[model samples]
Target: VVKERNLLEIIQKQFNLTDILINRRLKKRDINQCCQRLLDERQHFLNILTKCRLKIDKNYNLAQNGTISIPWDWSFASNETL
Candidate 1:
């Protein structure tokens, strides 16, 4: 009976250890996925900002050459008070 009890105890300990290891691996995987998702979102936002900057630069250059009128350039107002 003593030998049987010892064997059972050893088996139970190994099972507990395996369970713990599996839990740790699952948590690590979840964290990695979350980090990757955040990185993807940040890259998408940066791409949008880059496109906006390029468009603004193009508009500014066109306005400087008088090829297009900027909406904020209100210098052509008459002296009529409203």
Candidate 2:
């Protein structure tokens, strides 16, 4: 195709240029690149996650047995024991 021919022509023209590194790296390592990519992705993820609120099953019984007092042992669970 014309695109392929143009790309090869450009490569031949810039073959002696030392200002750039076009060599593909190995699959194993890109520590700095990986860290920077992860940092960028994490920032975007956190920006979206902070504005989201998780929904739970509201129909489920959270306290069906009875009104249990605080700091008391019961069938459900006692956080005081923790």
Candidate 3:
């Protein structure tokens, strides 16, 4: 429980810094702000990757059946343009 609480606290701090960097309207942004922005972007990208991994793992077995197909009718332009 202590480990989980510490992890949550760190995440909350990161999020708070991110929010500060995002919502601040200061005329002179500092290095700390830029660093925070980078951290936030990296964290956001990691979050996206994690979600994708979970989805792929959850659907892996179902996808193996090979019954899924996507329509491609909109992939090509009309012949009139040629």
Instruction: Assess each prediction's global lDDT (C-alpha) against the native.
Output: 0.28, 0.27, 0.30
Model 3 worst lDDT window (10 residues)? 51-60
What is the TM-score of each predicted model, taking all chains together? 0.21, 0.20, 0.24
lDDT for each residue of candidate 3 in 1-82, tens digit (9 for 90 to 100):
3543343334335544221111133212332333334345554434422222111111212135332211211122335321
Off by over 4 Å in 3: 17-42, 45-82
For candidate 2, the TM-score is 0.20
lDDT, model 1: 0.28
TM-score for candidate 3, residues paired by index = 0.24
Better of 1 and 3 by TM-score: 3
Which candidate, 2 or 3, has the higher TM-score?
3
Best by TM-score: 3
Give candidate 2 regions above 4 Å deviation. 16-82
What is candidate 3's CA lDDT for residue 13?
A: 56
